[model samples]
Target: MARLVRLVRRYFILGSGLHLVACGGGDSTEPPPPVTVTITPASATVNAGETQSFTATVTHATNPAVTWSATGGTITGAGATITFAAPLEGGPYQVTARSVADPARSATATVTVRAIAVTVSPAAVTIGAGGTQEFTATVSNSTSASVTWSATGGTIAGTGTTITYTAPATGGSYTVRAASTVDPSKSGSASATVTPVAVVVAPASRAAFRGEPVSVSATVTGAAVTGVNWTASCGTIAGAGTTVTWTAPQSPGNCTVTARSVLDPAVASVSMMTVRPAFLVTSLGDANDGVCSWTHCSLREALTAANADPGTDTISLVVPAPVGAAVANTIVLTTSLPAITTPVHIVGPGADVLAIDADATAGSPRRIFEFDGAFAGSLAGLTLTGG
Candidate 1:
C-alpha cells in the first residue's frame, strides 16, 4: 500500500509538466507593417516658368529615400524633398515621387501650369491734334484673350482689345497701355506722338513803311516736327523756323506774309501788310516845280510828287541856310502852290523858325496853299502869314 501511494504522486507531477509544455508560453513574433508613400500637397496650381517644392512621407520603409520625376518640365533634388520647374507651355503637368525602398508604392501630385502674355499691334504711332487713332491688343496662352486699354494722355473710347484714342486739342507725347483681363500685372504699352495740324501767324494785319523790317512769328500746334516755312508775296524773308524778319520792298503796295506748317503743307496762315510812301523836303523855296529830285527836294516839289503817288504819303521839311547873311528863314511864295488832290501829311521844322509868306506886292495876291477834291491832310510846325 505504501509503494502504490508513492507511484501515484509521481504520475500526477509528470501530467502537470506535459500540460504546461502543450500551452506553449515562450517569446512571440509579429509581421512588419506594409511600406507606403504619401506626398504633401496632392494638388497645386502655378504659373509657367515657376517653381514648386514637394515632400514625400514613407511609412514602414527600410529606406526613406525617394526618386523624383515629372510628366512635363524639369525635376531636381534627391531624397524625400524635390523641386519642380514648370515649362513655358501652358497645360496640366504631373509630379511623382517613388520610394527607393518600394518602387511599386509611389505618390503623385498634379501641377497645373499657365502661361500668360500680352502684345500690342502697331506699337508706335503719330496723330494730329484732335484726331483719332485705332489700336488693338493681342493676348496669348489664355482661354480669355480679352484685354483692358488705357491711355496716359487724351481720351480713350470703346472697349475690349480694340479701341480708339482721340488726341487732345494740345500736342504732346503720350502712351497707350494694354493689360490682360485675367492678369492685370502682365501688360504691354505703345508710344504715341500727337502733332498740331494748324499753323497760326501773329498780327493778322499791319501797316508798315517801305524798306522797313517787320518781325513775324508763327505758332504750330501738336506737331512732332515744330516750326514753319516763311514766305512773302512782295517782301524778302530772313531767317528760318517759327520766327523770321520780313523786309518790305521799296515799291508801295499791299503784301501778304504766309507761314505754312512744316508737317502739313496744306495748313498755312497769311498776314496782310500795307506799305506807304514817304518823302523829305530839303529846300524851303516856294518855286511851283513838279519835279522833286532825291537829293534836293523843295517843299512845293514834295507836294506835287505826293499827289501823284498812290496811298498815303508823308513829307518832312529841312530848310537850308540862305547865301546872304541878311536873308530871312522864310518861303516867299509868288503864286499859289499846286493843289493837293491826294492824302498827304506835311511836317516842317519849328513854327518859331520857319514861315510861309503869301504876300505878293507885284502880282495878284495869292494864297500860300490850296486843296482840291475831297481829301484828308495835315500841316504841322509851320507859320502862315499875309494870305
Candidate 2:
C-alpha cells in the first residue's frame, strides 16, 4: 500500500507542474502610464464688439476639473474658461489638469486667441443749420456683440452702424466715438462739420413812367436755398415769381424800389427814377395895329419885332392872334422855358407898308415862320408860331 500511495503522489505533483506551465501565470506586463497631457480649445476669435471664450480639458484624466490661465485674456469660473474682453489678443496661454491619486502627476495644455477688427463707411458727414445727417459703421468680424457709441461732448443720434445726428445749433466741429463690450481696447472715432448758406437780391438803376411797371428780381446762393422774398417801392404787384411790377405815383418825381432774398436777408438791391413837368399853350399877341406885320415883312421879321419889344419881353408863347388887333393877349407858358427880354421898334404902317397878324395852327408849315432877333434866354416869334 505504501508503495502505491507514493506513486499517486508523484503523479499528482507532475500534473500540477504541467498545469502551472500551461497557465503562464506570472503578473501581466502593462505599458507605462500614458504621458499625461491636457486638452484645451484655443481662445475664441471674436469681432471687435462680440464676446468669446476659451476652455480646457484633461486628455486622459481621472478628474475633469482643471486649472486654466490666459497670459492676456480674462479667466472665469474655476479658471477653466477664459473670456476675450475686447477683441482676441495675441499671447501664449496654458491649462493644467491634476489627478487626485497623484497630485504631482499633472497634465498641461496650450491656447491662442486671435484678434478682431472693424471698419466704418463715410467717415465724416456735413449738415446745414437746423438739419440732420446720417452715416453707417460696420463690424468686420464676430457676432452677438455689444457696442457703446459716444459723441464726446456731442449729440448721438442712433445706435449701431446706421445713425442719424442733428446738426449743432450753429455751425462748427463735432466728434464721435464707438466702443464694443467684447473689446474695450478696440475703439474708433470720427468727425463732422456743419455750415450755413446765404441768399441775395439785386435792384435796377432806373424807375419807370407813371403807368409803366418795372421788374424786381432776387437770387439765392450758397449750400441750399429754397425760396426768396421780393419787395417794391411804390405800385402794387405780386410778391411771388422772379419779377414784381412797380408803378410810379401820379405826381411825376423821383422814386426808389428794392428787392431782397429771403434766405439771406442781408443781401438786397435798389433802383431810382425822376419825374418832369409838362405844359400846353393857349394864346398869343396880334401883329396889325402897330404891333407887327406879316405882309412885306417875313414871319422871321414879325418874330424879331415881337421879341425885341420890351413890353412883351416876358410874355409866354400862345396859339392864334388877331391879324389886326391890339398888342395885349394871353398865352400859356412852358414850365422849364426861360423868359425873354428885348426892345424893338415898329416902322411899317399903312402909308409906306402894310402889317397883319394871325394865330398859329398845330399843322402850320415850318418855312412859314422866319425870325432874326436878339433876346435874353429863348424867344418864340409870331412868324415862328406860323401866324
Candidate 3:
C-alpha cells in the first residue's frame, strides 16, 4: 500500500507540471510582413546627355533604403530618390531601384533616350535672280549625321548635308530648310533674299551730226530704285533721270552711251551713236578762199572744210536770189573747188533753184570738181555746166 501511494503522487505531480507548461510557456510574438519596393514614374523619356529623376517607395522593410542602378547611362544619389543621366547614344535604357534590406525585392523603370538635333550653316544670305548658293547642314546627337535639304522659293540640288540652292527668276524673300534624316521633326532653317536688277537703253544705235543733241532714255527693271546713271564715251550728258540729252563732239567718231542700274553697278546696258561732219554754203560766188567762216561760207570754202574733216561729210548749199528778175541763184566759179579726198554728199535746195557755172576766164576750163583716188561722193539738187 505504501509503494502504490508513492507511484500515484509522482504521476499526479508530473501531469500538473505538463499542463502548466502547455498553458503558459509558449512564445506569443507575430512575424513581420514581406519586404516590397515600388518606383514612382514607372516610365520616362529624356534627351541624350539630359537628366531625369526617379523615386522609390519601400514597404515592409526594417531599413527603408534603395540602391540605384541602370543598364545603360549613369545613375546618382541614394536612398529612395535618384537622378539618372542619359548616355550620348540613343535608344531604350533601364533604371532599377533595389531594396537595401532585400536585393531580391527590386523595381525597374524604362527610360527612352532621344539624340537628334539639326543645324544649318550660312543662316542668312542674299542672291540674285537665277543665282546659286551652297548650304551645309550639321547634325548632332545622331550617328547618321545626315540631313535633307529643301527651299521655299528656289530649286534645291544634291542631297545630304551639302546642297545648292538656285534662286527663282523672280525676286523675293525665300527660306532654306534642313531636316535630320533620322528625325524629320528636328530641323533648322535659313533665310535668303533674292534681288534681280537689269537695265536697258533706248535707241540702240543712232547717227548724229557733230555738235548735235541726241535724246536717250533708260529703263530699269526688278529693282527697288528704278533709276539709272548715264555715262557717254565721247559726248556730254545734259541731264539726269531716265531721259537725257547727249551732245555729239565736234569731231566725227563712234560714241557709246551706257546706262547703269542705281541699285547694282554691275548691271548695265549700252547704245552706240555715230557722229559725222557737216558743212554749210551761204555765198553765191564759188571762190576758193583760205578760210571758211560759218556766216559767209562759199561752195569752194565749204568743200575745203569738208575734205579736211575725217569720215563721211555733208555739204548744205543756200545761195541768195538776185536783186530783180533772176532766173535762178547762180554761182560763178572763179577757181575750181577743192578735190574731195574723203566720202562726201553735197545737197542743195533744188536743182532748178541753184546753178553752178564752171566757166573761168583766167584759167583754162577744167572739170567742175575732181575726186581723189578711192573717193566715194554724191551730189544732188544742183545744175552744173561748162565742165
Best by lDDT: 3
Q: Model 1 segments beyond 4 Å from truth?
A: 1-35, 44-48, 60-65, 88-92, 99-104, 112-186, 190-195, 203-209, 212-217, 223-245, 252-256, 260-268, 272-387
Q: Please give the RMSD of candidate 1 to the true structure.
A: 10.9
How much lDDT does candidate 1 score?
A: 0.79
Candidate 3 least-lDDT 10 residues = 318-327
Candidate 1 worst ten-residue window by lDDT = 319-328
lDDT of 3 by residue, 1-387 (tens): 999999999999999999988887566557788898888789998776678899999999889898888989898778788899887768999999999899999999999998777778799988776678899999876656788888888799998789998877567899999987766877898898988777889899998765667899998776646788999999899999999998887677899999987666788899999875776677887666665555567888878877777778888787664345443787878767778898888998777778788885555866777878798888898888766
lDDT computed for candidate 3 = 0.82
Q: Go through the candidates in order and give each one's C-alpha lDDT.
A: 0.79, 0.46, 0.82
Judging by TM-score, tell me the better candidate of 1 and 2: 1
* Residue 83, candidate 1: alpha-carbon lDDT: 88
What CA RMSD would you report for each candidate? 10.9, 14.8, 9.5
lDDT (C-alpha) at residue 187 in model 3: 86
Model 2 quality (TM-score): 0.43
Q: List TM-scores for all candidates, in order.
A: 0.45, 0.43, 0.53
